[model samples]
Target chain A: MKASDGQLIGYEKEGSELWLWDDLPELHMEAGYRIDRLLHYERSPYQEISVAETAAFGRMLVLDGVPQVTEKDGYIYNEMITHLAMVTHPHPRHVAMIGGGDCGPAREAAKYTEVERIDVVEIDARVSEVCRLWLNRDPSERADSLTHLHHADGAKWIRKPPVPIDVLLIDRSDPYGPSAALYTKAFYKSVYDSLSADGITVFQSGSPFFDMKGLRITTQRLRSLFPVVRTYWTAIPSFPGGMWSFTLASKGTDPLLGCMDRLPTDTRYVNKAIIPAAFELPNFIQSALD
Target chain B: MKASDGQLIGYEKEGSELWLWDDLPELHMEAGYRIDRLLHYERSPYQEISVAETAAFGRMLVLDGVPQVTEKDGYIYNEMITHLAMVTHPHPRHVAMIGGGDCGPAREAAKYTEVERIDVVEIDARVSEVCRLWLNRDPSERADSLTHLHHADGAKWIRKPPVPIDVLLIDRSDPYGPSAALYTKAFYKSVYDSLSADGITVFQSGSPFFDMKGLRITTQRLRSLFPVVRTYWTAIPSFPGGMWSFTLASKGTDPLLGCMDRLPTDTRYVNKAIIPAAFELPNFIQSALD
Candidate 1:
């Protein structure tokens, strides 16, 4: 009774086990994990959030029918998106994570002792509630980085915050619908203006393989606003195209030039070597932007 | 109505569309491709070979329920497997391709004028015949590098060739079943013996993400024999784990040390920038092998 990644959630429907394939129509493919059971599913105020436990990949959270975060490889995305910016900044005390309602990135950001406070601005509160209550594996900590949550537009929240942010990590949905505005150059300019002098921003660009135009155009736009822009990638097995791209932008600091003198030892994906290696964009990807 | 990547061979079954996911049980997941129609399927004396026309990616060739080659990204694998070592060598005269039954590797090798001859030792003749007949888009030439096809066991053929190979490319299936011997130290010893004094060898190891042990151990064995060994990677979007690792070994000339002076201007994947970047192993992979 084993199935491929796109086995479409169930074998015989109607009364059988309910399964789902997060259909990526644009890519003409769908991706689904092997789920032991669908633990939770409902239409939130913004998008549909479904949480399921998989026999292979632990727990998987699908939002808007997209496999947003699975317990298995969520750390890879979370670590790269958050730590790349945090480590790049010499002294990152305050961090702002946008749309990572799952609270995975904040959990990792909180690991740094240098981080004094974190402001998580998410468009959806239900995502944070479900993840905090049932989805996420309890770290069993007294006060973790799941600290402040702003159920408001992330684009607007960055315009005027209480204090200037040192690191901004955009962990939002695909660049579509309300998330589309976050991808614009104006929004990035707003982010550039509302930051400390040495602040760094990291955001998921898109799949460099299939969505070449989107990634290429986005990087081009960022280059216009930021003094330094670097593109890096990692393989998320559950996501469509498998290869996911993220761009790092800094006003004056080059992420590649900014070295990790003091590094964390406990990480499965991100290590000292990857900081430089990941930035080495392939020939096709480099050409795609050109 | 839309099929997944591995759904190439099965669709519109009986009357309704019943897509099949080619389960890579080893990886504990299946893969599929969008299929407009199934072109051909039969046992090719060695394994099952199926040809299907896809909507997103062009033609797909599935071997033993595995979508081994797709026209969309076929050049990526073929170029990386062949050109990485070809370019590494100063002058590759005689190239021996083992287990590339589809004749794809030889077709790439034939492109270089410096390559006088290519001996394609494929155990499965039917794969070459099938590809040449239907799957391959020919270069419109008579007697290309694919002129010579020695349909024999690659493991045995490497022990005693008519002339020693200047460059040896192992383009076989995974290190399993009939292809298991090709991965052994004894077989590698034979390959080393069959190679010319400055011969270089490049072969697919395994995915570092899931098959960490396989790739690590294989690199370990290769390092014991070769003076210079380097591991590189490329992202094959449709493949399981998304990221695939390739290892390069040389008798005297190092792949990384070898410079790219004259570059091909027609390639979509391989270029001067990628030659070094690919060899920059991630910390996790380097640590796993270490």
Candidate 2:
């Protein structure tokens, strides 16, 4: 159930049914919206479903009323992940996104003026199928030319060899049950090893309130690996706990350390005035980081 | 129902029987192992009997699930209002709060250290009664001695004569139903008249997301009356809307123009490190402000 905005609102599902709700509007989208997209259902970790195509513009996945990912607001999160890193880096031509099966981040990666190639490593092929069938009506025509989708375990791919990646975006979920290994230090260091000298990597942590200890530990571990590591927070109306946090790690210059007056004029949520503002963590987060 | 940590999770009243839920575990109190207190009922806002007590002290106004005021967290908003002006001012001693009946803002006034005398003009006697009975069990035990709690309609009190209020805190509710007159320009001009040279006054506008038009009108009116007026926003978790906005106006010396360094200790939310962070309005607010 969502408490805040439609942008980052939470939704949950059971078996073939998918449901989403917000505070102002009691019930938003529901099972009727899910148009024959159920590929697989598993109750081992938690009641989660792998869906194919939905009547809604986006691919739907729900676990206990929490919307895992959707194609509509995917651009907001994807753009935030890819653009923030790409723009900060001096020249990030080669980029890698981990666990973003939907390829939304890859699509956003192609938008960067400086980026040449984008690689997406996702484990779930069903997610890619949903994206291709529903999310991207004309996938081949609309997607960025520089995009390359890979079906593989993101952590395993990063663990081994790779021609030095420039920007790596870890868009994985919580580090519990299914997504546990993804949050380990070994995977993060592998990610650090895969990046170029002046490379930057941005990873979606979890809600600062609910996932306090997780956020703190992951940020601390990433800080140990990278020269400059910082946590940035934002409020997405759809996300659980109403607030979300991200960890940015870089081997090159600390992007946040120095002020850069020049910024690309095409921004919706971010601007020159709020560059530093985004990095300003709450008291609870500050205490956790300390 | 309330969330954990002794926050006023939610409130519901059926007839004279009011239901209060504390999201957290049982709180410790001198009276006994305490639960949530029934602040008021729908039948009468003034008629409230404290059914419980707790060690965690603060003002609690439970109206249809929303806790309007609490003592512990009240300082955050009050400090934000009082300090945002006081620090920007060359000398701000004489202060007044328009509708802070709970005396929480008045209590925060005592913490300013700089201010010589503070007056709290409240329209309702029941608000003070509730605060004293349910929230602040011992009101006369504060360290500061210069606060004057006046029981009078703030709007009527401001119209009679200019009291030269250096820092005025307008802690009224939404402008639609009960608090309609408080949002008018006439009251704002009276507030302007009451302020000394370069004096500052901060007032709660409304939810930027839901009430953007209202926020714009209030801010525009404040700007017309004052030479320097800027809108500052802060996120209150328990508010009706997820994000809340405040308007900070001054006769001179734009509050946003200066750097905030000095601050009173014992602050859980605001500090020197995240001072600029408070002014970072959300995208919806920025759009409305623009």
Candidate 3:
């Protein structure tokens, strides 16, 4: 597919056969690794990567084509999404994750043995099947923690949550296609209603740099619905904008308040010292909200 | 350049020419703009961007490009790098960003007017010169906050910092080469010494995902030096690994503490509701420390 003009900017080849579009800009890769849809393309830091995978989840993103939840950098998203709410609740016995088919967040949630039952609400059943086949090769891992996997619309599912859930995670896709509706204030209000009084909800807001507008909109929407609503950003290199943001809202204690004292041991990232530091915001973001 | 036999693979480009090389396969984008170096390049994101200023600062590092700061998505990096430290320190008298010559962080940092002063400590004066001329045009908008511009070494300068700095942002290049010295425990200690008793420090650590080994080493190093040290990750589309991490340390209260109570009414991205949410860590990160 060519960009702008009728530029044939995409191509494919099989073994010795090569096919090139007339207008597709020259790709930096070799003649191998079949070119699929470009998830996100841009300049800066040697060109970022956040494209979908034709092989998995129908079209799951392949940011840099490397695994975001590998043994290396997985902690940032996995821990914050799961633990922030999991530990915040006075007693989070039964938990559920909405649209976390990757198992990255689910894998992180399972660490809390206190979470006796974990449910994953995924839109695409294929993603879970693929993850079970490829991503999570060990059945002993998330398999033990995951009590149920429901193939259903996350938004619709949360509106009338079946069972009593203490913590709910909205680890869905970007706020664009199927995931766009999830960003609305109504969906979050439903999420708030679905949770127990002491429950907490966390979800990945878009990048603040490029999606500051989206971040603000979502944060505001969530704020109107939840009593305790907050927005924080993190940095992951595989997204378009170098900076990323997340929103956490709870009807319980401030996640930041007394968090340092209660921090768990064996953490590679969060600690007592850095607890208060994560809440700080840079100028641009501060200006955006103010 | 060309890849050696069995060395691994990494690639980047300039103009119409594409280059490839071999290494361990680590791609890190530091300070949101420059590619520090290519550790490995077997498979890379070179074909992602329109080539032009490939070797602007240094070589288009095809591999081991130093995993500088990873966010789950880009929002956290922008938000944390901007808000986490900026909001905590009450009325940052002056702010100096070292190595963030690209202006993305600087632009983000400028949102705080309490930061009466901002100085960008850049090593390659050429980088700033070019960015000002090409990339970041509104120098008057944000760069004007920069009270000073120093081409000297950020490490050396931090040892004897200027202006009772309330916040010293080490937004430097990757943790290698000239910047490599910046990531040392000793360097962070200097940063610790440079800030006011209540001052805070936030800088990109590295990709805790792919650089878990590096994150462990750096976290261990930084933790020992500072009374409070925490590592958090964000995601960026440009980086190889999706999950990126940052370390925030402070001499006063925990960095994640506080709300946007003092924020000017004009601010856009930060507020009380969003404050505590930033401290939330994904589960994988929590497990890493374990």
Candidate 4:
């Protein structure tokens, strides 16, 4: 494609060649990746799911045309989303993950031996099936004996959780379509009721640059529902903005004092020093939260 | 553009409509922004420079098709690249910036009342001329009394002493073309020689995701020269990968012990809490540094 100056600016997708493009329409920006091979494609009751292999990020899972996770950088998101709350709670025994059909968060939670049961409520069972086949290549890597996969609506399931969740992780997509209800105050109140006294819940808050309003609203909602609320960020290249934020709402436990030293050494993103560091917001972001 | 499945993927550059496209060819990924109006375009002795106004980012300055600064988000990069080192140094009076032709680093340095002199050595006089007109809209905002703009090759200029630089900032583009020599060990040694006994120098390393090798090598080269070298990062949505890294090398002071409490209150991105927070590297990045 040629720019206005007739300068050869960008490459054009050739006919019959597969390429995945993600658009941040609100920000007037877009990112494109070349797909080497299409591994899986299906239209579930919820959203369109596709798995493609690319040289840059290996196998990538896309939901509703949005790149969800990739073999290369998925660990960063999974670890950041799970480990913070997991380590924060003194003794996280019962864990629950909502809408994480890909099982990436479940995989990270399973690393802790003390966790007896993990209930993953995903509305679409097809995502779990496809990801198991392509993304999660090693079934043995996950603790099958402890993890319970329930293909139920997370919003409904969270209203009456089977167990009191010590570390509740909401891994839903953007607040749109079926996931819109999951981001509401009512759903957050349900999450608050379903957790233990010292329980902590962490969920993706959206990109700070593109969705600061969403982030601010999420923080405000979480603050109203929980005693302690903290917003942290992590970098995931596949995400619309490489920097993605997450809000941790707890009944009692302080996220900044999380037992990061106990963080599994296998993690690629979260470490002891980075846990508190993530909570430190830049001046602009802090102003938004204020 | 259409995907292989006949899906409309991305917007096509229309006739006479300007769009800036930045390609990270090595990563097989690209990001594009819609330009509203073209303000200036020039081919100086160094490289291609263009300034345009965009709806999302307002006015943007592009050097060789790469977006350097935008009216909206330029503060993040300027504050991050400048404040970390500026705050780290105990009493930064004389500062030298190499290749920050846009006068951003100098403007940031001028924020400090103690900073008596700031010498900006830029190779392209056209960059300063264009940015002075478009990006740096307020000339009086800059402490012109304490600032000096020199149009010269930074590599050659740094070889000779230009007063004892308490804080040296290299705000050049990526390590290619005319900026290649600035990344060499010899130039870094020249920088080391020109600093005060307790001087601090910080420069943009690269994007951690797209340029890990480059970041690693830069950190290594700086470690070879300075007694204290620390790597930190900040997020800039317009920049490729959104997350950008910087390396700080000091003669005596520790970056983590920077006087962050004295950070300018008017700044947008940098704050006391974020100073130490920025120094915290994720496990994956720490592994790269190790």
Cα lDDT listed for each candidate: 0.75, 0.62, 0.57, 0.82
TM-scores of all candidate predictions against the true structure? 0.88, 0.76, 0.55, 0.93
Best by TM-score: 4
Rank by DockQ, descending? Answer: 4, 1, 2, 3
Tens-digit lDDT track of model 3 for A1-290: 22223222233343442222211022122211222343443322321223333321223333223323332334556665666665567677778888766676666666666667788887766556555654454344544546688888888888887776788888866555446668776787788888887788887887675567888887788777778877766655333433667788887777776344334564555555444445567556766776
Residue pairs whose backbone atoms clash in candidate 4: none
- Candidate 4 stretches with Cα past 4 Å from truth are A1-12, A15-17, A138-142, B1-12, B15-17, B138-142
Going through the candidates in order, their DockQ values are: 0.47, 0.16, 0.15, 0.64
At residue B228, candidate 2 shows an lDDT of 80
Query: Cα miss at B241, model 3 (Å)?
Result: 5.7
iRMSD (1 decimal) for each model: 2.2, 12.1, 9.2, 1.4
TM-score of 1: 0.88
Model 3 segments more than 4 A misplaced: A1-72, A137-146, A176-181, A184-186, A258-276, B1-290
TM-score of chain A of 3: 0.73
Cα lDDT tens digits for candidate 1, A82-117: 777777888888888888888777877777778887
Is candidate 3 or 4 superior in TM-score? 4
What is the per-residue lDDT of model 2 for residues A1-290, given as tens digits with 9 covering 90 to 100? 12122222233353555433322221111122333344433332333434433444245554433456655345446556665676677777888888766777776666556777778886666666655655564343324577777777788888763568888999987565446678887888888888888888998987675557878888888988888888887655334423567888988867675333434454455565566676777566787798
- Per-residue C-alpha lDDT of model 4 across residues B146-223, encoded as one tens digit per residue: 878889889999888569899999897878877888988899899999999999999899888778999999999999
Worst 10 residues of 4 chain A by lDDT: A1-10
